[model samples]
Target: MANIKLTVEEMKYMALLQDLTGAVARDCIIDNENNRIIFIVRPGDAGKAIGRRGANINKLRRLLGKEIEVIEHADDLEAMVKNIFAPARVLGIRLAQRNGRKILYVTVDPNDKGRAIGKGGRKVNIARLVLKRYFDIDDIKIR
Candidate 1:
């Protein structure tokens, strides 16, 4: 098994998430290089954990001083990728081998492409961060 690890910032953000949602956080991964955080919550609890209108997440973001991304605990890795791209409608997502490492390629509706890749490519950056930390992928490209 690949031994997953959390940085000190990730642990701190985990505590913040718990305090915000009163929900148990299964795993926390902080990507300092990308400046984001990803965490897992119980099944069927993604909305509650996010709170009404994302108030919970907003509060945590303010407290932790980092961008926060949340996903429901999922067993299937592809589903997890889909979850991250929710609201944007990813037409297809593929995992391919590149130089002996995994790379994620995400396809979104042509019209919604800009949304998937936000201003300064922030959204795509977040997706790449989560993909690397949670899926153990090394690279990501949205095409």
Candidate 2:
């Protein structure tokens, strides 16, 4: 795993998230360009992080003035990808090496292609960022 260094602001956000949701945050990614915050919580704590009717996340969004996304961490790359793209239903994940660079091939249900890609490809970009950060994946292809 690569060493991930957090800014003091991110650390403070993590502390706030933990206090608000009681979920241990594994990682936090702030996408300033997209005006969003992605939080990877310990497995089995997604519900807690989200809170009932998304109250916790909504509160964080209001407080931080950015959109919030909470994803549960997984030990396996495939499981992690699936968790990141939850509700979209990943049909499969295969790793491939091209030009000596590793890439992730993610197959999603035909009906969920749009959701997997998300508005302006934000979700796929998030997936790519997290995958590269944790697994060193060079790229991700959604099919």
Candidate 3:
């Protein structure tokens, strides 16, 4: 695990999320470009964060005026990557170190490649950002 830092604003968001969803968040990523907020909650708390029928997420979306995404945190890098790319079935995850940089190669179901990549590769970019922050991974290559 890498040393994680949360901005004051991020900490506020995390606090709000926990208050609203009853799930303590490990980290919060505010994607201003995407108009989205992503939260990584502690293990065994994803269900609580999402709530029944996604009521919690919907409420947060309305309150924050942006898309809200909740991901469960995992100690394992592979599991973390998989959680980040949920709804897009991942076939494999390979971590490679070259020189002084580390790269993650993720293989998703061929049919779900575009979904995993998201519009304009936004999903991959967010995944890469999260990986870099949480695991100190340098890059992510979606295959």
Q: Give Cα-based local distance difference scores for all models.
A: 0.76, 0.92, 0.90
Worst 10 residues of 3 by lDDT: 121-130
All candidates: TM-score: 0.80, 0.95, 0.88
Which number leads on TM-score?
Answer: 2
User: Which model, 1 or 2, shows the larger lDDT?
Assistant: 2
In model 2, the runs with Cα more than 4 Å from the true position are: none
Model 3 has how many clashing residue pairs?
0
List the candidate 1 regions with Cα displacement exceeding 4 Å. 7-9, 33-35
Q: Per-residue lDDT for 19-124 in model 1, tens only? A: 7788778778676776677777777778877899999988888877877777776667667766776677788888899789998888889988887787798777
Which regions of candidate 3 fall more than 4 Å away from where they truly are? none
Ranking by lDDT: 2, 3, 1
Model 1: weakest 10-residue lDDT segment is 1-10
